[model samples]
Target: MTIRPIVRYPDPRLALPAQPVTVFDDALRDLARDLLETMHAAPGIGITASHIGVSLRVVVLDLDPIDGARTYVNPEIIWASPEMIVHQEGSVSMPGVSDEVRRHARVRISYHDVDGNSHPEESEGLRAVCHQHEIDQLNGLFWIQRLSRLKRERLIKRFEKISRG
Candidate 1:
């Protein structure tokens, strides 16, 4: 598996919604492997196909090293709890910037595995946070947009400063 280059923030491609994965084939499996490699190399808990400029609805997450990586193709959040939870979120595309993001405390998502088999699972806490974050990426909504205008502006400024220095 190759570690693909992650598309950085402010890239117009990152703002566009991802296309759903229709075929479950070797290419899809390879892309999933590549995503896992790239996410692991980024040392990030989660990542999506859109993060690497691939507009496919795929996400890779590894919140627990002991359990290894998990791949999701055409993931869709079918249910979300009314209760909300806040978790510090970051993206491989954004690199150094991170902020708290509020989302449903629990979520049930339906997605396909590497072989295209459908699976639906419920998640909470950090797992739920990762799903929400990656799903937002798939929807073309950067995590920064979840912040207030003032906070978003400040964070962008800080990111620019860090990027320059």
Candidate 2:
């Protein structure tokens, strides 16, 4: 298992949008596997390729082992419920900081598997939150951007402190 290095917050790459994946081959499979290992090493439940400085539209989520690991390529939220729910969210890039993020209670997502098969998925609860969060990261919208200005500033300060000592 290869655990790739994670790109930390404030890295310009984290703010850049990733390109869509066009090839479905051994490389793509390797990338997916490396992403899973990197996420496990980071100890995060969800992670995107951008988190590891790879500008590809890929995400891995392992909320529970029973569900196994899931990889989404070029994932997009095709539909979202009007109802909203708040959940604590953070990123592998910006570890040690988290805040309540309000998102759709349910979401319908369209994406491709690592093998290049297209599929639509419906998710709720924490799964829904993760789908939105990782998709946003793929779109270059970091999780903290969803926070209030005051909260974001405070959180950044806290992260800075953590990084320093």
Candidate 3:
């Protein structure tokens, strides 16, 4: 597994939607492994193929390191709880910036495993937040969009300042 360079904020590729995985082969597995390595190196709990400039519907998440990482191919949020919760969120792509964003407290997602096997999982708490965050990236919805216009602008300005330092 290799630690791929993360595509930073303002990169046009991050804004583009990912293509669904059509072949679940060794290459797909390798990409998932690389994503996991990259996310761990970034010290982030979740990451997407888009983060590495690959336009593929893949996500890797490991909220609990002891439990190992989970890979999702062609992931889609199938249901969400009516109850919402606000969690501070950031991204590997947009390093050094974070803001609290409201999201479903619980979510049910349909995704495929590395071998193209179908899987459905329900997640809550940090896991739910991470899944929603990553799925947004897969759909080309950067986490900043979840923030209000004012908040997003401020965060980006702060990020720019940090980038220059």
- Candidate number of the best TM-score: 2
**Which pairs of residues collide in candidate 2?**
none
Clashing pairs in 1: none
Model 1 lDDT at residue 6: 88
lDDT of 3 by residue, 35-98 (tens): 9999989979899999999999999998775888899999999999999999999999888989
Question: What would the TM-score be for candidate 1 when compared with the true structure?
Answer: 0.97
Q: Give one digit per residue, the lDDT tens place, for model 2 in 1-165.
A: 699999999999998999999999999999999999999999999999999999999999999779899999999999999999999999899889999999999999999999999999999999999999999999999999999999999999999999998
How accurate locally is residue 62 in candidate 3, as Cα lDDT from 0 to 100?
87
- The best candidate by lDDT is 2
Model 3, residue 85: displacement in angstroms? 0.1
- What's the distance in Å from true for residue 107, model 3? 0.5
